[model samples]
Target: MRHLFLNGPVQNGPFTFATRPGKAVGIRLAAALNAILGLPPTPHLWNTVTLAGDLRHREADGPTIPRQRFEADLITDKYPPGQFPVGGIMTDTDAEVARLALEMIENNLCAGTLTISRETVPSCRACGHMTGTGSHPCNACGSTDTEDRTGLHLVAELAKDRPVLDRSDIHASHRQQPRHLQNTAGNVAERLILSRTRDHGIDLSPHGLDGLVLDPRVGIHVTVLAAARRHEADTAVMTITENAANHIAAHGQHFREHGGARLQYALHGYLPYDHTASLQPLHEAYRATQAIKESFETWFLPLFSLRTKTATSPEQLPALFKHYMRAHLAQPAEVNAAAFNAVQHAVGAGNVSWITNKQGLANVMAARRAPIPSAAGPAHG
Candidate 1:
């Protein structure tokens, strides 16, 4: 058994917790998950409108919160560098309270406290000007102490459960033909007709397209997973690609081999088949898109094995989710030409602007450049 110890000032000093129950879950607990699945040391996601009545989510399911005991002896004693008596030298101690406190700390860790380590120190950055015989200058920065900055802090590490992808074209180029076809020109063309009818909920017969090629960038869709860590509010995005899909499969296998639970999984992409107009052609195309998307998910699943240990692979995930687990995967609503034109009109020229329909890739990327409309709010596009 191995242990990780982080320093912090959260009442308890050093503590230990178990990752596994009596039996190993087969897969080793992800270190990143351990780092995040707990109460945050700072208030970034959950907010408090008032003190005492603080509004923050606490750890209900974390490693430290588990009620199991592991077989081991963890001892913390301050002793001189010499041989000492084994059982007769303790001058003062409270073993029962100490044991209870350790148990509580373990419980909290199991409940996702995410609290690794902490410590309290004087406000050295602001304490630079106080002058007196007994008064001491800031230990960090030499100045008279004026104010105190005291609070709990954590030394944290992050773990991720996302599939990695290689941005290089070569990696994508080697994926199964179906996946590549679905991502490239073929799926793009299929999506244009699907979006027009499916998104508007209308018929597609009136607008004739005997000969047309849809644009890939404007039509192809991908699902993204989003999750957050303790103390962090920014949602991390994970765009599932061929490589990522395969990685998940491989990871599952690795878990099974290592005395872990076996996962019979499927990468299910949500299909959008809703349409307002009762056009036959539109309905046919909408149905076809949904079928194709489902087929793609089935086709992509059997191409890989689970990974036993961490190793280098050729994969690329978006920048925001390069290092964490808990991501989301969803197909965003399409942005049409008229909507694009409207966004341009509203933002005006000279100043740069982007267009997206709150739920697609464009909108996700556009969110970084400007204040994209909230899901419940209206926008020019």
Candidate 2:
């Protein structure tokens, strides 16, 4: 199976990796997994189709710099200087993603899964922003005056045959399937609005829904598939948190599969990055170097999150740190082929138990320093 892991497109919000390392967890996880699999790098995904993005752009040189350029600039700043991504960056509204989204929508329409229907939605009278079903003031333009407006919008009728998220929709081993997440994600409304009035997005003008754009939730799925299609990956595993997965699962119902490719969410947990500094004492005791500490925080912890599937508490950091140091100390002079192959297969099979094994971690660390396998092929990230 050709599997590619891609980070769920992060919102182009105000935060850098240096300040909020949590934001880069998904990106780091994807890169680490792809490296282990001997697959080329995959493009990092970004979500620019947001109302906050519109207001931010307008506030900061609206006419001077393009929104795309604005979002790209912010993403670049998130990376370290001179260490830009080798896989490049793919935004939600990229031309290729837009084209593929429209094509997918068309196919869904033909299959009667999606429709162009007239919807009476509340809109801000000031900026014409879709305020949604709420009595509160508009998020955009801060307008309290809202009125119901009728327009042709893209709508999706939730299928009755299956839940929004099923076991098959998750990238997990049989024993680790998240039944609770599956139940929660399927709790969305039966009918969904797939179009929004965002300033920057995959425009639906081509479908005659003028001034409307594809909802970011659906665009997120398309962005992953778009990246997967580029790499010729049949199975695209999107690294995301369970909370995020539940939020977008319903909207992505019809967007998960297209042509011969399939998209699956690999649920990961939250890291207590704020508490990492407290591990300095433990670091000293273990004689852990800066390199070992950095690796444990950035790489190992993200992989550990895949196993935990929920918030890893601050109290657990010290033990986790000690575990990592032990693995670092156990690193062999060379990677054992048999051990490395098992680790690789575990990754491909969505099994993460090997992550906590000391010997397994040592073998993986050694494998990272070795020459790339001939099967790794050319740069694709």
Candidate 3:
């Protein structure tokens, strides 16, 4: 599995560890105890020590002390000036024990780890190549001076192995930080850099057996990455909507009559979040001429109205107009001119009649057969 090793403050949602030493202590404790107990050890005891109860308490011989302090006291169980010779090995053994405990804690935190995105990609003094993988000699210039980097390849690998994705989205600073393990409050700079670098041109693949290496340099250009991500997200969403439309077109008329709101909701979430940027090229190559916007609306609206048990929202009117335009602009589809005319006519400008009635036609014909209007108001017949 893709493992992420971070050396920093651990923030589990609302809870935060006050000190780094606390984290170190926990890791060291886990490691030491595991070694002493042997593999496949009993769980009840380990759970009791590490997770169940607090171990920092003084023996009934003295004043109460914190668990850590009490544990220390046990090793140095001495006081005052002693006139007798003491064991040489007992000199400051408490400090040694504390140090060992910390090491064990660190080991436990990192045990069984196949690969870590944070440590694999180290920062360089020169060009920022955060990913651990680099061409043996720089591929760009065939020089040995090139640095390796990492990014999405690691994320992809983690996804494949199912590492219980704690957090997929991170701020730019979090990405830049080497030990971005907290899964929250990460280095945003690193994320943006990696995203941009990859966007320009970079292959991101995991670098472990059934896992991937993540590079930190990929955070360079966030704007480009965001744009690309949005495009891709949009395309996928639209594809689904189009498929829904196609299904309705082929299967039955009910969807065609009442599916606008459903389609709207789908597009609402899909469009802004799409990842693929270049859609026009795909459309042109396929010679697609369907009015997707209108089709989507037609399918969604009726269904939405039925579910809500109310008329369409007034706010939706403008959106419908925009959809109408999008549906008609592309070559694959044609808007119904009659329907458009009817709506326009309801407004003042289009209400005038363009056609002449029979009486008007007759008057025109008679006028051509007779003389023009007289000067004195009206001439005698």
Candidate 4:
């Protein structure tokens, strides 16, 4: 199958990638794997259809900017000057994503997997925002008073024949499957309300569910599929955290596949960016150059996260760096065609074992260097 790795849509919160490097793990992981597979860069996906976004826009002091422009500007700020992604950016509420989401929703509604019905939910008494089922004050207006409000909502009926998130929904080898995520993702109610009160989102008004938007959880799925569709990929592998996958999997049940394209989560772990400074001594010892340091931080670290599917502890940094330096040092004088092909095949087949194997990593690194022979000079480290 033709596959492409895409980051799980990131929330457009107020944070720069420089300060919060952890947030870019998914994006970096997807980019690394896609590069290994020889796929062109894919647009970085962002989830701008968030309540936080709405609140931020509302509270901004100035002549009002369009919500779309406001989100675009915020996303652009995440990257450093002149360092935006080469593949460009795509927000969850982009026109193409909205179109795809509505199409999927319609198909689900027709197939009895989704329905539009009146739902009674808690609402902030002061601001008329949906407060969900919590005792805390409203997130939008910080009001303590809430009331049970009834309104039209788009609902999804979880598939009766299968779990919300099964093995097929994940992009991992059988032995590496995430059982905990599967169990927890299936723990939600049988019926899920898929519409929300948002000032900006994939508007459900097109389907007669006026004043509501597609749930961001589900919209994120469509965003991935929409990006895959653009590239004509049959399978879109989304790099996401296990916790995030569990939170959104249930809502994305009926939205994972469309037009012969399927979406699957590739669960990854957090990196210890805070402890990366610990590698300073190693950098000195290895005489690492800026390129080598960047390659380790942006490429190898993310790929490593796939192997260690939980947080990579601060203590593990030294060992991980040593392993990386070993691979860097062992990078073959020339690409091994057979080994390179094997690594590509393994990447396509969702086998991450090669990442931890020194020889395999060397061969893959050789392959990465092959395209630009002039740039394949010995690593200064």
Candidates' lDDT values, in order? 0.22, 0.91, 0.24, 0.89
lDDT of 1 by residue, 32-101 (tens): 1122222222211110111111111112233233211100111112122342223221110123212322
Best by lDDT: 2
TM per candidate comes to 0.16, 0.96, 0.16, 0.96
Model 1 misplaced regions, further than 4 Å: 1-115, 119-259, 262-270, 276-381
Ranking by lDDT: 2, 4, 3, 1
How many Å off is the CA of 258 in candidate 2?
A: 1.0
lDDT of 1 at 66: 21
Instruction: Give the distance in Å from residue 166's predicted Cα in candidate 1 to where it truly belongs.
Output: 9.1
Worst 10 residues of 1 by lDDT: 218-227
Model 3: weakest 10-residue lDDT segment is 43-52
- In TM-score terms, candidate 3 sits at 0.16
Question: Clashing pairs in model 2?
Answer: 41-381, 42-381, 87-381
Q: Write candidate 2's Cα lDDT for 172-288 as tens digits.
A: 999999999989988888999999988899999999999999999999999999999999999999999999998999999999999899999998999999989899899888888
List residue ranges in candidate 4 displaced over 4 A: 372-381
For residues 169-219, write the lDDT of model 3, one tens digit per residue: 111122222122323222122211121122111222222312221121111
